[model samples]
Target: MNETIIRPNPSIVYMIFQLKTNQPSSKLIYSIGPNGVFPDTQGMLQQHSDAISTVIDYSQGETSEVSYLKLRRSHGVINMTSWSILMIMGYIIARHFKKWDPIWFYLHASIQTISFVAGTAGILIGYALSKKVDANVNNHKNIAIIILVLGILQVFAIILRPKPESKLRKYWNWYHHYIGRILIIFAIANTIYGLSLAKEGSKWFLAYGISIAILVIITIILEVRMWIVARRKTQSTNNSSHPQSLEFAYQT
Candidate 1:
């Protein structure tokens, strides 16, 4: 029987499965936590080699030297997924539901602000990882850049929004709302692309795929609800104006 070995950086979990059997082996290892066998202070390098040594033998060795290269690579994917989700569905939902208090807007703003910072780090790590891995640059990286740009624009509109009673207030609101929605849509697209870029066997990537689908469905529902509300408002306005029109007719 052939034996396989895998070593993954810390903070990342990797599983190996036999393609012929379509089943994961009984032995599973993580790069972090008590089960994590690799030692690089913080799970920098996960290595897979021929299974010459037993699991017990491998687990006994300790090598805790921190490696910058491996740590950066491992951190990028996690941060990118987290920030992308926040900038898209998280903040947008806050905007949609926060009608009663100013705190919702503040919360939305704060989350996106943190997401932007995280996103910046993710992008830098992406650039470095791209050089090392055969990532789908056109499909994943390009789309991500588009999302980052739109996110930045949305944040800018948020920061420069006019006061509530200002003459430009309505326009500012429109800009803020529309741009945020656009950012959400782009973020969703980028997330799907990122999922494709992740390795096929990665459970984390599969979970992300499911989450993206759910977010997309939720966004559609929200849009339909907004449309219904707008239509009702229009109909109400028309009904209210009918009496005025009748009064004008009598005057004429």
Candidate 2:
């Protein structure tokens, strides 16, 4: 067995620390070098003044929440995955797969529900980051709050949806459609705003922009094709019915 002790130099002062100010076990010790900076590469240092002498380095990595930057990134990625990618895909399926009928409707509902859940998770992460850093993200935070509210409205809209035969169904449709679009718009914008503030880089921002553009183009083409198919069906049905009406009149 062996022991070595390094007592704090009482004359040393003006040391700064980061992360945890103290390791939760005991008192703190600090050191300053000739440049008035902490000798550690992080430019800060923390030491327990009363720590027991130990030759074994048994300290563990952080067991608390993940790093600040990782949390920020997760927030962006989650919301983008849910609202921008999955939610838009749901809209496309419903719009272009009209012949799928109840199946398409079910798929649409299921996907949007999952999207809301993921977006909600992202919202929680964003809130945590806000409290952790507490700076310069007002625009992103405000937009997120709006999106969350809209998400709740959409959820209630589904729950309170009118029956197909109900007189108010058309108005419900209008409300649901418009609000969903607005929520998607805000979610996408907030994601971009977050990317801009992110310290990592611009690659994610570029990728997301390209993806949303592709979705928009696909939506346009599908919308046009849907209308064309609907018009053809209506004309075919009209033409097929006239001969039966003429035949009945002649028999009478």
Candidate 3:
């Protein structure tokens, strides 16, 4: 008969066996380091010992802390990307294609719906991973909750949108835009926090930085163009009214 004691760590499993034979109890301990061979003592043991060691190594390797972290990181990345695309890119597209009317609206709505679904799934996965890892990321969790609530509210707002001719349409537009802007800002902040927790490399930051910079630049350009167009339209309208004024003055 043999009593086995297993000690598990982030990267390795240490197994100690105490065998009860005709002689006094003999103790054998073997530590299985990452990508290392089994202890010399393991070779001296019976076939059963070899089988046990193999099982321990395989199990530990599969469920290592590194593997869990990778899984969590993937979830975070997906959530961040989805939210960014929908909130930032989709908003820009909707504004840019406003002249296309119903087409832009449909595109915006579809993107937002997909983003919400992906973000919800990501949050659920993160919660499960946090519990498994016993993580204490209260700020990240709180921000995520806020984002989810705002997203749900946005969806409902769209569903209950008033007709363009209705007086309430103006109020609905204001509420929708303000809430969306807040949600996007908080979502980006939370995503950065999550990246920090994941201990990602500099490349991830660089990628996101570039993306945000491009979005900002494009938005600025579009805004300036819109302003110029509006100004020209106003000038044209004023010039057309000048002829009517001159005719009335001449008759007087």
Candidate 4:
């Protein structure tokens, strides 16, 4: 019997059953660690995970290095899109498009949700890739985990957002803004760390660097424009009120 199985990444429970039978009792369900052969953190890469379960026993000792290398590269690419592109895009929408009102909120939420989901997937893949490689990734892994936790908090904060006129709204705004800014900082730092570890290529690094530079430039321009617009509106209001002041003086 075929069962449609859907689960989160790195699910802990494991089930074993004969394919030809529809008996639930026959299935043996148990808890499982990363690989069938459980190991400590330092020995994680030594275990034969499903992704790189096979190894050559020949004298040359050529194993699954190629596959794991490709997996590492794929992990890097996923994080690049997730943290670098989607997260930054969400931030831009929320910060720069306030004039869009509620529409900006929706776009920001959607983009951030996607970014969080993608980032989760990237970290999971990174963990799985870790089981297949020997490079030290403790710091990178810790930073990514922190990012995940912060992302969850951000989601909850959105869900529990206070109304504009609420007394607590200002505090909420501060928490949201500062936490988001910190999250972005960590995400960028982790991405740079991953890139350096991957050592993919100079061209890839150049492209990522260029993209970041462009984003910074755009943000600066929009920020200046916001200042200019606010100042012009303030000046216009002052100029319009000067005639009223003169009229009041004449009447007096």
**Which one is best on TM-score?**
3
lDDT tens per residue, model 2, 71-149: 7778888999997789899888877887888899999999999999999999888888777654457788899889989
lDDT of all predictions, in order shown? Answer: 0.63, 0.76, 0.76, 0.77
Q: Which residues of candidate 4, in runs, are more than 4 Å off?
A: 1-66
Alpha carbon lDDT at 147, candidate 4: 90
TM-scores, in order shown?
A: 0.56, 0.68, 0.74, 0.72
Once all C-alphas are superposed, what RMSD does model 2 give against the true structure? 10.3
- State the lDDT of candidate 1 residue by residue for 1-252, as single tens digits: 144456676865455533334553433333322344454766344443212111222354432422244544454455555565776655555746767477776777777788777777777777776664423366667766776787688768877878878999988888777777676666666655555555335676667767766776787888798899989999999999999999999999
Off by over 4 Å in 2: 1-67, 234-252
**How do all the candidates rank in terms of TM-score, highest first?**
3, 4, 2, 1
Q: What is the C-alpha RMSD of each candidate to the true structure, in Å?
A: 11.9, 10.3, 10.0, 13.1
| Tens digit per residue, CA lDDT, model 3, 1-252 | 378888989977786675555644122233223344443564542221212111123334332122365668778777887777458887887778789888898888888888888888988888888775556678889889999999999989988999999999999999999898898998888888888877688888778878888898999999999999999999999999999999999999
TM-score, cand. 3 vs. native: 0.74
Error (Å) of candidate 3 at residue 69 is 3.1
Give candidate 2's TM-score.
0.68
Clashing pairs in 1: 5-48, 6-47, 6-48, 7-46, 7-47, 7-48, 8-46, 9-46, 10-43
